[model samples]
Target: MRVAIIHDELMRRGGAEQVVLTMLKAFPDADIYTIAYNSEGTYPEYKEYKEKINTSSFQIFSKSIKLMQKFYFPWGIIAMKAVKVTDYDIVIISNTHCAKYVNIDSKALVFIYTYTPFRLAWNPSSYSQYNNAKGVFKWIFDKVISCLKYIDFKAALRGDYFLAMTEETAQRIKDAYKVDDIKIIQPDVKTRNFYVSKQPGDYYLVVSRLEHYKKVDLAIEAFNELGLKLIVVGNGTKAAELKAMAKNNIEFKSGLSSKELADLYANCKAFVFPQHEDYGITPLEANASGRPVIAYGKGGVLETMIPYDVHESKCTAVFFNDQTAESLINAVKTAEHLIFDPAFIRKHAELFDENVFIKQFKSFVEEKYEEHSSSVIKSH
Candidate 1:
């Protein structure tokens, strides 16, 4: 059967992009469709599949267009709507935004795998940029978001089946689209690429985009007060502001290869994850490296990381309840004193390996497609 994969954008190396890459492995022959793609900006592995990748009209612009794409929501919507996947037997959308609006053939089944309902449209208050806007700007922003939410909701209804990365995301999809039937298929980590190091490094590691919502600032503040070394990897809009806030003990690095990142995860004393994510991959990546995580005790992390307070023997992370630096500092201190078993951590992470996701996802699609075909035959 012919299959087509649609993703919102291939502009960066992120969890959602990773999911799309995994999907490609499941359906190697599937053509990929997206709103925008930046070869240099996103995963280098995508270059190998360049022949099968297709982008919208916006692809003519430079990479900077991705950063400003939020402002061109209407154009993005139009761009996706213009994409016709009418010939494919199955259209699997790896969506966090407008990809769901893509035109699909009535004979085909569309499976939408969401990272989360578009956060900027559904949960505006969570973004610092939205919260910092002025009276008129904020008013305009609110109105625009309201309109986008309506459009997003209508587009979501086109999916024959919906899948989410985590339970948190499943609930968000339910709230955003009022859709009751949803499947939860968590994303995976490349556990085999990582190994437990003989010796741990002196510095704590943070591998996340330096964004306002990521709460990287909290890690900087805690490390500054503790006078401990922190190595932060990844860059974003808040990069400059976060660098300015960090002290000499904090160091920033970006653009590391998969092997290099796995090495850092293997050697670091602990991985610091301050953000509340839809379903965090970094913490699991850390676990795959046989390292413990120091994370905020909320959101998707709760489902993955075994917290020390709850299950001391099985714990893979230390959880900080509050979002403040003081709370994180306390958790860091607690982590410093605890003994974590690298072997056990690695074993736990193996459950969410890339192969596992591929197997589960392919099975779900095949089973559902069979059911869909049977129904169509009955309708005739």
Candidate 2:
């Protein structure tokens, strides 16, 4: 079969990009289509698939990440519309943004693996930038989002099948697109690549993009008050502002290799995850390294982390109820008193291994394709 994979953009090595890379491994022969491609800005592994990767007319504007960020919405929609996938027998869209709008053959089986319905368009309140805007700018932003949401909803109807990264995201898809039939397929981690250290270091760890929504500031505040060591790994638009807010106890690092990150996970006392994510992978990565997680008790983490309960012996994390420093600090104190088993933590993480994701994803595609083929034959 002539298979194609369409992703929103290739500008950064975030969780969505990681899912795209895994999809590439599952369908090695499939040609990749994207709105943008930035070799240095994204994962180096993508270079291996350079020949099979194709971009849209927006590639010229996307060459600069800053320019792409400025005009990503309407331009993304236009660029995706221009991508012709009509020749392909199957088109799998790995979408968080606008890739669902790609033109495909009427006979092609199109599967959309979505991270979340376009958050900026459907849920503008979640974004700090959007909330910070005032008067005419906020009014214009809302008007544009309204238009984009309509377009996004129409694009969503084109998918022959839909897969969500988590149950939380599935509900979001249903609410945003009004699409009821959705499958939940959680993203996985390389559990085997991590190992438990016999001796953990004297610091907590955080591995996430320093974004406004991530709530890294809460961690900084909690750690500052506790006067404990914290090593934050990852950078983003909020890097400078976050760095300035952090005290001397909080150290920031970025651009570490996978191995380096795994090592940090292995040696840290515990992982700090303050954000409410669609489906978080960092907490699982920490658990894979046989470390406990101190996380906000909401969103996708609730599905992944086994919260500390007196009745549950397999608990791998302590949960904070709110996004405030006091709530997190109290959770940290509770975690300090509890004893976690590394073997059990690692075992829990193994349930969401990359191999499992590949197997399930491939099987689902093959089964659906066979059904589609049978239907096409009957139609003819």
lDDT of 2 by residue, 1-380 (tens): 98899999998778888888888778889999999899977988999999999999889876576688687777767887988987888899998787888888797889999988888888788889899999999999989999988888898888989999878889998898888999888898878779999999989999998888889999999999999899999888889999998999999999888789889999999999999998898999999999999999988898899999883357889999988999999999888887889999999999999888888898899899999899888999
Q: Rate the local accuracy (lDDT) of all candidates.
A: 0.89, 0.89
Which runs of model 2 end up more than 4 angstroms from their true locations? Answer: 61-64, 311-313
Name the lDDT of candidate 1: 0.89
Clashing pairs in 2: none
Which residue runs does candidate 1 get wrong by more than 4 Å? Answer: 65-67, 310-313
Most accurate candidate by lDDT: 1
Query: Clash totals for all models, in order?
Result: 0, 0
